[model samples]
Target: MKKIIFIICPFIGLYWLMSSCEDFLEVEAPNHIITSEVVFNNDETAIGALNGIYNQLYTSAFSSGWQDSVTALAGLSSDILEVIRSTNITLKEYDQNEINPNNTRNFNIWSSGYNIIYMTNSLLEGLANSNNVTDETRNRLEGEAKFIRAFTYFNLVNLYDDIPLLTSKDYRSNALAARNSSEEVYELIIRDLENSINLLGESYLDGERTRINNYTSMALLARVYLYRENWGYAESLSEKVIAQSGIYELLENLDEVFLANSKEAIWQISPAGRGTITSHTNEGSIFIINPIFASLSHFKLSTGFVNSFQEEDKRFQDWIRFHSGLSVYYPYKYKIRNSTESITEYSMVLRLAEQYLIRAEARVMQDNLIGAIDDIDKIRSRAGLELLAETNPGISKEALRETIMEERKRELFTEWGHRWMDLKRTGRAAELLGANNSLWQDTDILYPIPEEERMKNPNLTQNAGY
Candidate 1:
């Protein structure tokens, strides 16, 4: 029960990336001094090691990096955010949907993702050898590490389709790792999430929602199942989370949903750097362009997305803000424009509203039209709109599925790459993006593997039409 002292050893992190294959996943060598005995002998050091992983998550190198993180790449690659036509080729590539194999943004995302996975493996390896930490502490730490590894891989596989699946800290295996099919990667993701659910406790490790708990694992697994079209599992998991009424509830006020302590948030990330409510590192600050700082914003909400929301929709009215005398509208969900006295909001990763949407989609596929409509209405009711039946009665199965997609667009826009990934998974990316984006093609759904990676690893094959 020693007081956890956070430690940073840069060389240990560097060791994981130093492989002869030049493959970003390579992490075969380490020159650091701390051994398993010192690093994981007690709960404090073990948890501190895990906190280091979360620190990596906060830094610009990972979640906060505008060029590489999903907050930007996924936003631009999809239709939600329109990038300013500027000289930044990386941003332009995603905006134009004409990315090349060598696009640095692709490289950044690939490398950063594996760096996190490698760190998680390191944590798992240390935890396995620890005898000083109590059994309860060990189980929780293992669960959190597994959850993080699974979440990182989920993002990688969704974007790259076929990717190297690395679970151990062995650099040789990592260097020689070949791309696994999407199916294989998904199986690993499911297995890890299931393991985490069994090991993690129901309560949050801390009062803040930044830490992953059993519900967080369940929420993510439900999303993975929905993506895989495992309707029964997805529906049941979504229902389990939804039943936690004492712990979670939909916010009546639209503006309150993104607050740091919002009842809606299942898991959130504390802002990096300045460590204030309005830290520039917060994704909210990046999305909200303050006039005092810049004359031109990085990006703005698309006209189509803006117009898609009904005039009466509460989200459109409250969550989106229009610049004076300009047609451009930016996401106003994260209200603090700059660093403030206290932190007011955390970057939201998973929430209760999405669970409702997940259940709705699962119900649609099972031909439970009434049940599906019921779930959709829960979201609509909170949005200050009438129920689905009141507006569009007796909707057919095909039409109801489409309705759920539209609901997702209005509810989840600009949050993550939800819109972009939604389109790809539903077989609608080509049809929807082709008509709107001149550069979009049917094959543009999967980004090409970084060219440098292919050159170093002869075993790695480039994605089609790179």
Candidate 2:
């Protein structure tokens, strides 16, 4: 019996009829019209299936439901964000450290992430048995699918701790599987990333920033290593990416970092249309508030985060914007909220600045203080601030470690839940979050498994706090 599955299908009969050159369809094609045999046998159809995942990523309920992404959810759970004194229960719950298992945002992120993973697994299974595509296309497509799966699982493991690992589209197996240990999840993530690095080419596909390349996989691996405290491997991997100086450079202008086609971006999500005003799908649209369009300003930068930056830091000067009348500040890294005529920025997922921080943290863990300080300085100098050693000559390794952590807080705030995860990874979440919110407890680190998922799958277990 065919088990009921919920992922949106990206292949349609109309998809096969349309020219492959007609890029960026706004909606997913119906699932019934195409089968795995057809998608895997025809390169155009397979490409459509892959591109459909990207389209779904941009507008998927998980990515932008309630105009909230994991970034927002995680930020609110940390010290970097607070609700805008509004009656929005969801926003308040996250800020108050009172997440309900039934929270819509949590459900969307969990379901959406698994949905994308299932689609990728389906494509991978089809690709493995097919012979229609050329070797180059097969390798690229396989590598890309694995990369997406690894990325999705990375988010899942960190957020849920031990989630069911899905690598196939078999509903009987996938639907009833129990959560894998976090260590097991990491092992699978490492294996998938290793496969991705081996299979992906050095070149970006179709000259687009949206696709993950070989280095993109490496960058994410370095991050994974950092999180797992695999210092030597993480440092080496991050160094390899930083060595690609010709292809990737840290832009001197902070303003240009988030712009479309920015040199710093390793992977970004393309918006649905060309315009200065952000589409509703763009994550920036949720943060940007304008009377003309009346976009939601669900959360604001926490005073703790806003005041963390040094007075002379260029990020403080350029990337943080405030409304004088409202006396509230929002992240200005994504400059275009509404479109004027042409698209100006894409939602940045992976970038060079983070690689530096990853290497720095890894280096510090390995006792390579000099190398770590250099990496930190690269970000500092770019941010129009003095180098660490310059500012504090003969700073001890302990001091330098704290400095790097603070730099990450200042640089990566409001971007992703980098701050939230960073705190959790360093085992500082309880101290920091507890101080920020009296309601916070140590178990708050792991979000509860969504109530609906738990009810549907006997294997699912709720986190302790919830």
- Candidate with maximal lDDT: 1
Per-residue CA lDDT of candidate 2, range 1-466, in tens?
Answer: 1122333233521112111101112224445544677666767767767777776676555454234577888888888888875689977888888889998777777877887787788789878878887788888888988988998889889988998887886656676778889999899899999999999978887778888899999999999999999999998998899899877899999998987768898888878522224453355666765646333467678887888888899999998888764678887777766664566787888889999999988888778888888899999999988887677767787888888989988888876588889999999998888975778788899988988777667777788978
Q: List the lowest-lDDT window of 10 residues for candidate 1.
A: 11-20
Candidate 1 lDDT score relative to the true structure: 0.80
lDDT of 2: 0.77
In order of appearance, the predictions have TM-scores of 0.92, 0.91
lDDT of 1 by residue, 45-86 (tens): 777777777756765333653546876788887878887546
Alpha carbon lDDT at 432, candidate 1: 81
- RMSD (CA, Å), candidate 1 to true, equals 4.3
Model 1 scores a TM of 0.92
